[model samples]
Target: MKRLMKTTIAFILMLMLTVLPACTMSDSAKDLNSSAKNEVGKSGESITLRLTLWGAPNEISVYKKVIANFEAKNPNVKVELQSIPTDYDTKLTTMVAGNDEPDVAMMESGSIALPLAEEGKFLNLQTFLEKDPDLSLDSLVPNITYSSEVGNIIGIAPGPESYALFYNEDAFKDAGLTAPPSKVSEAWTWEEFVEVAKQLTLDNKGRNAADPEFDPKNIKQYGVNIGTFWGAYSNFIYSNGGDFISADGKTFALNQPEAVEALQKLADLVNVHHVAPSPVQAKNIPATNVALQTRKVAMVVDGQWNSSSLADTNTNFNVGVLPVMKEPVSTVVCGMFSIFKSTEHPEESWELVKALIDPEGSIDMLTYGTWMPSLKTWYTEDELVSKWTDNLKSRPSGYKDAVIDVMLNNSHQTPTGYVKNFNKIMDVVTPALDKVWLGQQTAQEAMDAIADKAQAQVKGRRDLE
Candidate 1:
């Protein structure tokens, strides 16, 4: 009996020792696994982020190269690039409505960015900028940076985009002119510009605007090709001391006398002066390529992106760039990349954005001539300016100065509210403006109709407040 009790006690003690040690080992393993997962979550050690943008084939190629380089340097984070089509706003709207928003997206200036920012779809970048002192806000051009501040900076301007006049040097010489004005500060007033354009306009018999036989009906070439796009038209309107919307953002001011005068002048170019292509003719050309390449028009106002198109073609004419309206006033279209509030990795998304707008990246874009650098310091520095001018052996005389003026002065933005509903209202205004251009309706009648309809739509939107 004594032997039996002793055996039982020994067995119980042995079992307790074995089980306790095994249970401790199991607990330790679980702790190690939990710690590793926490570290991964904190560091974003192995994660993929989605970036969305719209670009042409070459533009996408360039972006891909930049992304590859970024990925190599950032081993723990990977980026999947999704190339959205040019109709990005439509695509984005659908995606957002479906609750499948991209982690990051490139937004257009004026209407697209303002409305999206108001919807609270984008992450507030002010918080990130505040945390990173190395990301200098001062480096960006003041106006460009100011445009990005939708209720305090929802994004950063990734590229410096601006509008300038593109002129055909051969056409100028054909008109017996010395050269198109290059400096915006020294640019000709509207009257002076019209006079030069009139000289460039020719009839089949080679008669000029001053000649009585220079028949508008039998014209061989237009002196200018003013874009009929809403954004382009706004440049003219704003430069003439007119505005589409009031400063308070509540009312449409486009029916004012100044605004009417600006519209009349634009119409006169087609109807009275017979120097610019009619809106119908401009639309039929599809892109500006035919007008510029064939030298059918002497001058046209276009954005920096047109540089690539000009370079890609075999046209031998020297290209010159100037600011808007030949007046000191101009408007700039500044676009940026915004991270959505639903982004899974806000920190990583910002890092990618920083890489894209870094000084080195800015230099690459500037060298391409499709974009101006957004950095203020780079604009003043001789080295940066020389990159575009000194190397361009084909550049027309005074071309560099004109581009520089566009960079320095005459860069402004439409009021925030105007930008918010840009496309919606443009749809209304374009057809009405077209009617005026087609002679179906007078400028006053067309503008009055546009003002009434636009005001109603805008008022309804504001009432949602």
Candidate 2:
């Protein structure tokens, strides 16, 4: 009898502990729903908040219309969009250090977003998220929610981004080859890509890279141009089953067999194959949009952001899915609007965050081909997808498959971006990698030289410690 009473009492206590909170949460969520429909401010009240972002003038022009629509939705709120053009990440650091950070700042996923969120500089979004039950992250691509979190969510993404092949159709035609595949299902293999690049590469004497007499120097056109930046190289690293960080996330993985092989391939493009311009010459090439369209380069590895510029210029180009190496994979980028912990109006700032991500609000940026909506409803609900994509002049041919389909199925998170103290780790590793880029040494030799020190920084960096 005593044992039975004790067991019954314990079970009752456990149920109270779990069930009571769930009931409370249900009520809280309901209350928040009610508040959302009502104006938080008094009738006709007004507030102004500074929103920081970085983009070219054309991007800014479109964002202004987005802001106007947001303002119309909440008549009392005025959002001033401030564009930070150069060294955007460093500028954001300065703002945080000076206590002059904007109420809502656009934070790109990866290293930049991670450190700040970990430091508690951004608001703890747990309560905000719990309260706003209507905010759906269901459609957010993989790694987005992870980037937004460091124990607690510090932000919510407005849209997601990924890399894809952007090729000049005229360049391909001139090379006597058809354009590369537009869909991921038909992506070119690394060997096929290199051969195509050779066809497009030409010298002043009109010799292609495939020609035995092709001049290595004084080349008039490169077959392909690959950026050394993270966004571009990462796709190669991942596709080859290599990564810069170890699986445990505590050490450098750049010296691994897979990574070493991948780096060698990148170096080979400039040094051995001569299909791409030299590292020095690459610095002088025009922007990807201009170089591809003007026939200075045949194909370029770049992000989806170039889509808008290409559309606006009416350039003769087509989207190509990323080339496959040992596997089919590519890196993705997601950008979010985060409220600072110092903001006087947390609720109002959240309102802006919503307006940035909501299906209705994000369509302007989405249709322009600069972003993929993070809302699942946008893709799953025809009424929603058509609402934004249809009648949008900026969307390119096969965008539905190349951008949307790939984003949903093919893209993966960047490893270096997620690892702690990654920026410091890269600082040690980049110079060593640069030697490979410049053809001073093979990738294996250069990375092996710096492997120990790079891992040291990853495990016990001074700044991050």
Candidate 3:
């Protein structure tokens, strides 16, 4: 059920763990870069570069100020900004088809960057990036920076990102248990995590899931929400030591024992253990902030982007690193600033891309917890980390350990599913998930039935090796 459809529930581009549509760069790195070239030095000529991105009006307003600041710093180069209010992919596709694409585009990470790069519609940025002294692409999250590539580096995003366990501290206090792990070393094993969750869940009759008399039907507070629409359940697949696709990007692993077991455990939370809400029952639950704030749920496994939503809640919640099954891990998701091949102002555009992704471009947004920095400096350099994570208005408790550490060390990008062929695979597998969620079959049973179709789709993809 991870990102099966076009409509996004929480964060629009939140469905994927990783994508690889573009070709890898050759070792010599000579032909990896496109013919496009501009000098390394700052441009002295007066010019304008058309920039395009999608966002709500307020986000656009915030970016407009960012653009204004960029323009002030580069007085000679002006920016013509275009905002796509809706159907960003459709509009972007249309623009590309019409040969009217923007010079620098804020492409949604998985969906747009990979396919467009595959089509050779974007310039290879490896050469230009090699000259940078101030910004090191190596310092960025490889899952994000490495997202767009076809024979060369073509895309880069400014932040490191990951999903985490957000739990109510007061609820943990009431449960008489220590809060979940803050650092990866202390992360819980699957059984330990489930035991803790069972303790936190309470029925209206004042019973927990551990009680044999506990009722699943009249539950008042659930221990966790697997984030039915937020793609949280998929992480269990990774945690259990399996993947949606193989390293060669040529096979699906949904039917593997590890993944099947992982899926069963997730389902058991609802169907068997009755510690978490059913996918259908999750509809009654409020947003992440409201659910945790109101104590309707004890914990939520969700993305870092959700902190902004929780800032107003008086829940006194704190974040914890994800639990380990076989190993500590997390699913990484972030968008990138990619350059369109049609852009005439490649040098000037690269400058803008760097400015936007760097901490200074949108420090306030990062500080507010909507995003985390992609630059290594944000994690390694104390002053840079403080610039984003140390703030009165933002920075939930234990965030440095939960969000920052996990992203830099433990996270991996979900395979983009053979050049956006994921939807095709999910189209066939989601029905199986629906049945499993409804208790029509066991996780292995559902996956076993779908194995032929999934492997067929995986092996049939033209994009994968």
Global lDDT of model 1 = 0.68
| Per-residue alpha-carbon lDDT of candidate 2 for residues 280-336, written as tens digits (9 for 90 to 100) | 988779998889777788888888878877877757888778788887776876667
In angstroms, how far off is 309's CA in candidate 2? Answer: 1.8
lDDT scores in order: 0.68, 0.76, 0.76
Instruction: Arrange candidates by lDDT, descending.
Output: 2, 3, 1
Residue 380 of model 3, lDDT score? 82
Best by lDDT: 2
For 215-309, candidate 1 gives per-residue lDDT tens digits of 88776777877767655666778777777766556666667777777877888888888888786566554355557678677777776666656
Pitting candidate 2 against candidate 3, the one with the higher TM-score is 3
Model 3 segments more than 4 A misplaced: 1-43, 147-151, 391-393, 417-420, 459-465
Per-residue lDDT, model 3, residue 2, is 30
Q: Provide the lDDT at 222 for model 1.
A: 74
Model 2 alpha-carbon drift over 4 Å, by segment: 1-48, 76-83, 86-95, 109-112, 146-151, 380-383, 386-394, 459-465
